[model samples]
Target: MSLSGTRTHLVQTARLNTFVREAGDPSAPVLVLVHGNVSSSVFFDALIEELSDTYRMIAPDYRGYGGSERKTIDATRGMADFSDDVVALLDALEITEPVDLLGWSAGGNIVLQVAIDHPGRVRKLILEAGGSPYGFGGTHGQDGTPTAADFAGTGGGTANPDFCARLAAGDRGEEATSPLTTLRAVYVKQGFTFDPEVEQRYLDGMLATSVGDDIYPGDSVPSDNWPGSGPGTTGTNNGLSPKYLNQRAFADLDPAPPVLWIRGEDDVIVSDTSLFDLAQLGKLGAIPDYPGEDVAPTQPMVSQLRAVLEAAGEVTEIVYADCGHSPHLEHPERFVADVRAFVQ
Candidate 1:
């Protein structure tokens, strides 16, 4: 069959250059997947294939995270900034109707912000290990920091400052390291391990090409998705982009989309943050101020975030049994089946 989906490269002038994948029928529902921190569009390879027969899927390599441009000034990064990319990508595709938004880990919050900011864009939402929003100070304190630290121990494809600087600047198009396969394998096997070919392409596509790696080293994320592309001189010119970690961006948002929360019981990444994390975020220069904050500087605010979502009747909670932060990758069959049911 004509490969279920087609890949297209888009450059909106000097503003953005994004790679988009579309599968299944044009008339079918649209499914958009966003990867968490240190991850790119490659993680959804299996979901794309399984759902390709039904839904049209769109996965974008967030700036500094995938085959997109690197941002030098660090101004291009942030969850809100990434949300903007998602919105732009959809507009470019001429898809104006509500679409199914699925965000794994950090990506979940990205899509959530979009749904909250533009409710018309989403119908159903699936957050696989949807992380807590620690930046906006949801109901906690002065700083926007979540206390939960159970995120999978996967290293960012490359932590080299130079690489981070370039990747953060939004220039993943022609040069970038392949996806971190070593990390992917551990996470995959820990949760939903899959067929090898998908993993190979995923690993290959994340490189910077000069490495002569086996992967394609797609133009997203920090350099090094493919093999042989050793770390290069990416050069960091900016501070962390506000979008990559902006918590206040979601303060005004209360996305009413149907939310499915799937998590594995043993997920170390999903740590139970104390209330202090939220309180700190609220007092930060960005978040609005709250009253009577007495918790020590060490309290985590993840619980408060949970409270916020719980108040939203549209949320559905599912425990991933003994899995870690990535239940979907941990249990792909279950993940796909649940997703299919939710969208249906």
Candidate 2:
């Protein structure tokens, strides 16, 4: 599963031992790539290769995912724990100059946190199928108002137990809840396929996810609201909960960096009608006791993102037709070209 021209290694940042995948010249302007949930930096291999000639690419595994040190994510800090780890990695590498950042899915939220907290450290920002500034699920409207006081339909409890079980067991079979099936059905658009070897590599990354109450999906608490569960104060999923995570302050930054927002037109994971959103599922009758739209309306994820980024400053958006969550993999050439044109 080794990618040509890519170098993989571990860096002992102050926070943890971060496994990093690097490509291109070390002296070139750095372009840090952050991956989303259930996957690792390995997801960016193709894009790194395509843009290596002009950018020093550094993709690191988050603490509980891929080859990074396994550690408990303090959900109370939102994504600060993850963003601080990225900052520590840059410090360890002596990359004092601001670097370009590109985050995919959940990673997009982490990068936005970095830009919000450490604005001077980022030269530019790119979000690919990124999460909303208010975090994922349990919210509605462009302003991201909470559907329930407990933020019930979001976080660890929102994860499918069967999918987590299959992932923990490294089930490569194409069963409906298996990682492979999710890869094809959710990670990319329907009918899209990856090269067998590349697919295996990506699956390997997915399988590396550390499953536990203090890690993937984190922990949950019983809620009085619909779906009956709320985010617990630990784990990655809770960290992503609107209760713990919110990047709306990004708009308040004195000098926000320019942004390039890219996403697949067919992305479902972070869409307004995301299948994973409990409210959306309830509305569709997939989950019972939906509590109606007023009590628990579908989250306007894309609209929330657009509103925040627009308020922040400069933003350039690109939507690719016939694509899904992983635009870099589905349209590497265009993705790289779009990024190059922006970062340059």
Candidate 3:
């Protein structure tokens, strides 16, 4: 659905049909927003509306999410598939000039891949509670060392089955494991609540996730590691595995684009002790078969990101207190001010 000053439509790129939400004047400087996993471009609706006067905002729902064509994500390619899709969309729109890019969560990794592969395409880069350069889970340290040779405990298999089931069933109830509850508990910090209408919109976006073996959680392989499973070669979760998605090369760029890294101080999802990390869970006794800290430790996501950005060159880091994984949602006024300062 279109929001005030915004329009939703489908754009057929060379790779697939993509759903796009756009706002602001066509002649304005372009600012592309890429949403994270389990969510579509709809998450950016408020931001688009907030900044419509200054930017030609473009938010596209990548494959396997929102109204985009459902396609199996090739985990072996890392984030190349998604990054290429973004570039293809830009090409389809005849946007030849470099544009400002903002990526949230998984979308952050995709944008980094884009900058690494096609540096000239991005005028500046913004990562909001982005994933580690080394991928999401099954890794440790600021360097992102794999926990196992097979990269166990970090793939489609790691996904909570009940959560996926609920997602597939489109369960909109307030059950503990339901999408709404997860969004409420995990998406943001504790005690934070969305406006009722906005909450429903975001919930609808979350439910749009395509579910299948080659989709949402993807597939996995047997392993002798502590988790007893490894990343499979298909689906979104596997595609995000450290085994496949590693953008360490981003630091090697001769002259990387300026970057603005914004994250919440209390972000549980991407924090060093991320609750989602099986290793962290194991340490906290939430998962059985503790492998000890030496064998498995919480991934130092923020430090790793800082290291890469520092090495890459010009970088600005902003941490918001009393916030969670989504600074944009929690502090829209501040978020917009930061963006305006950085991009202007």
Best by lDDT: 2
Q: Give the least accurate 10-residue stretch of model 2, judged by summed lDDT.
A: 1-10
Tell me the whole-model lDDT of each prediction, alpha carbons only: 0.53, 0.93, 0.92
Query: Model 3, 217: alpha-carbon shift in Å?
Result: 1.0
Q: What is candidate 1's TM-score against the reference?
A: 0.65
Per candidate, the number of residue pairs that clash is 91, 0, 0
TM-score for each candidate, following the candidate numbering? 0.65, 0.99, 0.99
1-344: candidate 2 lDDT, tens digit per residue:
44799999999988999999999999999999999999999888888888899999999999989999999999999999999999999999999999999999999999999998898899999999999999889888888888888899888999999999999999999999999999999999999989999999999999999999988989999998899999998888999999999889999887889999999999999998988888899999999977898888999899999999999989999999999998998988888889999999
* Residue 337 shift from truth in candidate 2, angstroms: 0.6
| Candidate 3 clashing pairs, residues 3+ apart or interchain | none
**Candidate with more favorable, higher lDDT: 1 or 3:** 3
Query: Between 1 and 2, whose lDDT is larger?
Result: 2
Off by over 4 Å in 3: none
Candidate 3 per-residue lDDT over residues 223-251, each given as its tens digit: 99887889999988888899998888999
